[model samples]
Target: MPNGGSRPIFILSEDTERERGRDAQRSNIQAAKAIGNAVSSTLGPKGMDKMLVDSMGDVVITNDGVTILDEMDVDHPAAKMIIEVAETQEDEVGDGTTTAVIMAAELLEEAEELLERGIHPTVIASGFSKAASKSEEFLEAMAEEISIDDEEMLTRVATTSMTGKRVEANVDVLADLAFRAVKQVAEESDGYSIDLDNVKVETREGGSVNDSSLIDGMLVDEDRDHPGMPRRVEDAKIALLNVAMEIKETETDSEISVTSPDALQKFKDYEEGELREMVDKVKEAGANVVLSQKDIDDIAQHFLAKKDIFAISSMSSSDIEKLARATGGTVVTSLDDISSGDLGKAGLVEERKISGEEMTFIENCENPKAVSVLIRGGTEHIVEEAERSLIDAMSVVSRSIESGKTVAGGGASEIELAMKVADFSDSVSGKEALAVRAFADAIESIPRILAENAGMDPIDTIVELRSKHEGNGKTWGIDAYSGEVTDMLDGGIIEPLPIKTQAVSSASEAAVMVLRIDDVIAAKGEEGGEGPPAGGPGGAPGGMPGGMSGGM
Candidate 1:
């Protein structure tokens, strides 16, 4: 309220923070471009790794774009949107996360130039939308259908995904494992479906990465529960029990008073009797091997060992589920429900010590629906990185089988798409045509970055690529290994079609969203009164015009 008798006058506080017009647009575009530049160097086979140290001083070293962006503590809204572009690309295609983010940044950078030429944001956004849809159409037309049974091509796709990672020495071996694993778990219905969960990857640090091998059945991280039990069971009839061997308590808390010595004796006798009955039920079901999700009582263990049965207790629920799928068994919830049909069959169930740790291997099922891959590396970090690489490989193979198509990699697909998009720009007219042309130029950044990362002159490499592509050599791409422009298809550089298609759609959408923002309003700080000055949360360093002043 103003002075006493005057009518209440409404007014905005002086501390209110807001930025409109060019100021807001510049701040957002700068933040997004900064994030893109941070990851542009890590784009290809010759790309270098990023070593990120968090607040806890923990270090993560990887060239994987998604990992780098995910680990960064980005604060700016526009920067966060760029991270979403990477995440979406990863979630949909499992590879090309970096490419998606880089593409979006370049698109926004180009849009900024159009903005300076007085083109409206809506005009630029609409042009980008058209370019994105056209690129997808070009990608589908350019893609080559491949049979899921084509193991050689699948291996190439997997290897291409892992080429820039830390596990370069064993990429072939790992790629083979990944291809086999995905194929082993793939199912064909109306279309192909792959449950990657069925393909488990377990890592151990001791032997070299070449030691990694795929198992036809599931692997349990546990060993035999009792030493007296058989170390190995042949022609194993396995029972999966969720019920505990020990006596279960009442649903509600109740007291069982034992005032005399005879009462205690009776209690012990009752528990022993119940355990014996449980063991008898399992044996009657002809289950020579037992895997229990709950603990096994000492008395129960002795009885099972005396019967010469192989038994392990406290198995994880996930392991138990995998065992059921791999061995064609049903998880019985109660001992009394044990039946022959509930037992799983395995050629052999054995306990082996690998790297000084005991693990149970259930092998040689008739037709396993689930499998495992044991990844062995020389060190812990290597094993971890190998697992990441294998996951990427597995995901790419799965996507390829699902989509049933692939495209030449090594920047070949991008260059082809760029040329097609550039040709498309000719059909459109006015300011929108310039925006479409900028989009075509943005797509070329992939090949440009690939050449730059390989230490070659980007200009000469792109020129050669453009010439080759323009001459109808659609598969010609920069060979990062030798820095020579050659046939990516003949060189065995390939990737799943979904990766490129997803990158185009996701990156363009994100770029248009950022371009559409023309105003920003920040609430005042609790202690500082005003939140941030007009341009953004902070002033640009050295007073550089249109610099990213916000902490992103």
Candidate 2:
């Protein structure tokens, strides 16, 4: 080159940092899109499963978008951002896991174009935050009308929550059960706990609800016998009969030899009377039955039977303690050691039923409200899936009830808010006008997401197209899936659906945030492990592209 000639080292440089930064942003956007597409089809009750196999041949099949994303072990930075969004949604709402994942993916897609045009990500993020706040405000204003006062509306809430599955067995039935359980607990005592843990909903085809009964104490499965032994106990009392006849043993398995003949005779006489007195003492202590771990001699057994006392041999120590707790009694080891105070009392078990659902309540328990939900299924896998669904349903439904209110389904409120924003788009100030327009566009996606998940073509559907309608029998805009459609009003389409409003809010937040970042630092050390730790503005000594700080 110094000699004014072309050389082998042909170097035409632009700015490597700028170039790489763009690449990183693109990579992030692409990764999010992949995750979104992966979960998009898997929304709703009829959603399908994603079968993922790890490098080690481990396989997982689940329709849960969060589960799929979590198990995939994503490495892309942008993909990780989407995963973080899913985690945030899961951490907050027990439902909406899939919706969050897919919506985040859609946001990145929308941001990629703006990023290509040299607009800074920070500006986009700010717009997104503003829009999100406005959208939430609009939703709140619309939420005042949807109330939980009516029982019919309560069932509707349950039905909406259970939308897309085979829950027809009884959404109303389950809701009523939950309501009654809450009422019962509230009526029973002050400061009572109303929880799914205490109120069980078991589905037994043949089990009658009329068979429900309350037991007057606690019933924990405390079996001390061998595992295969009988599980049920009936009409039993404290039995403290000891099998050992003699009071003293001189040696192991050896008959004792007394030095004095009178001493030996006295020993024999004392042993005979002591055994009889031990039995009588226990009977006086109110023990109607006796259980002996050691072998009972014939004399003691005959004497006990004659006294109308029933004795069972070979009782386990654990079962004895269990019996004691159940009957509010204490375990007696020796009959001679028994006293009237040692015996506790137990009452009869009662049964009642309602609506063909059987419930068991333990009466006289230390805590009367303590109940367990025993979910049953025809098969193991079916039961497991049902259990998972029930747990999620219980959590969401309980929170909704306790909160006493929620917005309409299918994102109706959010769509209404977006419409309001669009209606006033012409009156907004300077940069915010553009931001508001973007916000409206973002809000409109809510319905598309819902329709797409619901097995309808959102781009070609009436509801999705109607969201962009400008009134006066005219609708013109690019559909969410990049399709062009007009005449939405003539198609007789109405307002945005509930799921749509939710999806728009979520997607807008995510998409706007992606375009806000201008710099990405990915440091990998030569040691093949994590790079050195660093944070904030000082960390970028070499300078970053677009003069953006690595603080984010």
Candidate 3:
């Protein structure tokens, strides 16, 4: 065992695909359970908060499941897939992040049991699909009788996403605001297209301003320091990008040498003249406003001010379109690109001097274009949470409003879908029938997620109860850790339950799919955390960096 002769240090053997498959399945199940449990309580308006703390002891209080998963410091690749499901929902609906995550976890849990009992993952997956379709039909049938105008619809929608919690109050306010904002923007247009950002949902320490007045056009930004930024325009034109282009950088190894005093003086004169000439050329081109990448120099600023020309600096290229729309003006990066038609006729801003600053209202135009939202917040923390919620709310509401309708809230939509799928699966032959159970398992994930979030043991409870109920021939049911199959309708816990089910189903399905992947794709610069220490795996890191980074 020393140097010359090598005895077996440890009879090492490469794992066969079969062996690795087992491990992979286990890992997938564990990861799925983790995700399901994590977002369970985030369901319903009354849903509880998940106090996520990082190594630094920073804590986050939130009932939003997708947010919790996205912010959680998860290591497993499979778990990351669950995160992706939440991300997908956030991207698609701006809401349903929680529902997606919880459903995923539940799917995985059920899959794990089914797999252990000799059912193929593919079978479970198929079954789950069937169940999903069947569930959808059920929900639709249930919902058809429910009037959209009924206040219960609002409560049901709210409660479905969030349990009956204090947060429902906040969600209600935001939902109302979202609805109003969408309506206002749509009313201004013939088509469904609306400038979502224009609906400013500001939470001010003061109060809301509710004055309703019509402008011939729109105002993009609330304020522009210059007096000539124009409030309205006719026949507006625009462009928008996500970059600034004011600051100029010198090329590498480029040099300008002036040895003598006369030469230096000539160089200075030439530079100043060129700068002045450039400004003159832009003005000659009929440009009234020049939105720059950086703040203007004193000379340029003075020149524009004197010319009664407005030059807004430090503007992102994308916002230029909004400015152009709001002012019925043209937006271009290079001043040379501007045209006569591009420059729409401008209007004046109504100004009122308040304190030392001026409050200006720019209005009146035909088909004006602009984009902006004035976000107001109170203290730092309150503002932070409000902003996060608002961004998500905006994303969800915008997409739904644009699409002309909202889905059943709290995941009832998905559950009903799953049930329909189950019926369809029964009509199919062979492997297709497997989809029925897979889909049902998928829909079941919602309730499992709720149980997990409520600090109930999802696996032990759901599994035991399912097993017992199965023996008793109750094929359609929900299992509780308390070993009960209580009627959901009688319990007054129906809508939100579906939300949790959806989350779990989505999470589990996605997780299982990811785990089945045997190949590891290498991505450059991916931050793979080190393995768990000798002690144990730790809690997730702090919530995602402040600001609207992760949401749609």
Candidate 4:
């Protein structure tokens, strides 16, 4: 109002939808809360799975937080922000995606209460930031330094991740395999660095989940391309190629016209010679097994098979790299570069029928730095879920090894941190203390939901947990399977400290980011399309908010 009251000046386009003040904050908080509530039930070992069917009716059945959020066809911008929290947690720690999303939702929920009580969003954000920072210090103090030699504890970390994954009867075996694969590929340079990508996973739907096995080397999906080739190569010498074995075609568009039949016969003979030369090059390199990124012509395959060379074509570039790491071989780009020195070695390169499909297994490389895990289950959905479970298990194990720190799981860490944070909040003065205390309560929601998901009474569980930790029971927490409060450490429930810290930090950041927003503007998309594609940050996130107070 420049003078008293004039026409409301509109800086945005006429069709934009805008929300301001409490209304905007409320909308964002509600959307975030909805997302959290959606995944809260899938929290603990006894937690149930969600079966999400997309618009195309593609079904995904699992409790993996990031996967669920990823598969969700959400349109709300605020809800999408919550998904970012889960994505960050997953990308950083590989586990704790659900915990992170749930924490952010609870934080916003607590902030909503503060907002109603007239606390500024900035004050709440500041308090939450302080709480998150202090919690990190507390968590570090609580963590016990672990080493790779702590195999039993590492196994426990993996087992804790897979507990509620609808996994097979042999969880112990699966956990062992997960950590084993991590150990195999675990490398140390400046510090402990584990390339999880080096740990290859293949899922099969024939055998039971217990039948899953970890291989010492890489697994190629395609078997030897020709039947005449040797099915097994002992002391195998592998030649990895990125070039095609067929005759090279000209780059330009041209046509060949032969006036005589002899000319065409000469052309065919030259092509045959070129293909034979390609096979001869591989044979000259003394490569018993051939894996290529491009196709091998039928004539070349026939010649290679006649030479008793095991040949597989059309492999992904990733497979080629994995084979290089597994077999200690070099990838030769050109046929001329195919030499004996360039070949990789494996104790056995064999093709075996797995679930009615023949696949190649390159195993027993000397001190291999890469490996594969063949995950098996009786059904397709089970196999998919097991793959997800194993990913979580392997991720926790690797994070544990790299950080060399461990914490008691089963809500033990969350309860103790909440108490500490609550005490810290009381030391603070002013309205900010309320937001700090709110953060403490929000973190406690983790343990509360864990209990709830386990079919136990959340109030009783929290009460018992608080009582246990009141003295010096930092490791005391609920056991999801037994519905009993006990020492999580002694019960073989543990997690990497990084996972917990990352979840808390990311959740707080997301909550603060969402809370600080008091205005939302969704402008029309550029070129006058549907909405907000070319629009600035003020533009709609995906599409305009429904029935906002504006032209659109």
What value does the lDDT take at residue 33 in candidate 4? Answer: 82
lDDT tens per residue, model 1, 1-552? 676988877565666566678877887888888888889989999999989889998888899999999998765667788899999998888999999999999999999999999999999999999999999999999988887889999999999999978999899999999998888888889988988889878888898999999888888888898999999999999999998998887999898899999999999999999999999999999999999999999999999999999999998898899899899999999888789999999999999999999998999887788999999999877888899899999999999889989999989999899989999999998889999999999999999999999999999998898899889899899899897999998998999999999999999999999898887766565654334533343445211224544323
Model 4 off-target regions past 4 Å? 1-8, 251-263, 523-552
Q: After superposing candidate 3, which stretches have Cα over 4 Å from the reference? A: 1-23, 53-59, 129-173, 180-289, 333-340, 344-370, 405-407, 410-435, 441-552
Give lDDT tens digits, candidate 2, residues 1-552. Answer: 344565555253322122246655665566667767767776654456677788998666556556677786544455566777777665544456677676666556656665666556665566566666666666555442222344455445554444453433544444444333433333223322235444444443333222222333433222221222222234434453334432545666777578998998997777767767766776777765554555555666666666655554554554445445445565665555777676644332222242343222223433334333444445443344444455444444444454444554443443456676665557765555555666666555655665565566766654644544435222332232223343322321212123333444556666666555546654442343233222211122212222223211
Model 1 clash tally, residue pairs? 0
Specify the poorest-scoring 10-residue window by lDDT in model 3: 534-543
Better of 2 and 4 by TM-score: 4
Best by TM-score: 1
Please, what are the lDDT tens digits per residue for candidate 3 over residues 1-552?
A: 244576545333222112245555664456556665666665644367766777898776676666677668765556677788888766555666766676666666666666777776666665555555455445434442322233434333333333343234455554444443444455334435655555433233322212112343333333444554453322222322122322344676678888999999997776666556556655666655555544555555556555555555665444454455555565555545655556544454444332234433344444454322333333434444554665554554444344433343322344345555555667877754764556565665664554554456767646654554445322223323233444333333333223333444455457547546533322222333542321111212211112211211
lDDT of 3: 0.49
lDDT of 4 by residue, 1-552 (tens): 254586666567787867789878877777788788889988988888899998888788988889999997665678888899999988888999999999999999999999999999999999999999999999999998888878999999999988888784668888999989999999888768999999999988887888899889998788888899999999999999999999888999999999999999999999999999999999988998999999999999999999999999999999999889988889888998789999999999899999899989999888788899999988888888888889999999999999999999999999999999999998988998999899999999999999988889999999999999998999998898898999999999999999999999999999999998988887665565554433233434322244332211
lDDT of 3 at 509: 54
Cα deviation of 78, candidate 1, in Å: 0.6
> Considering lDDT, which of the candidate structures 1 and 2 is the better prediction for this target?
1
> How well does candidate 1 score on lDDT at residue 481?
89
Query: Per TM-score, what order, best first?
Result: 1, 4, 3, 2
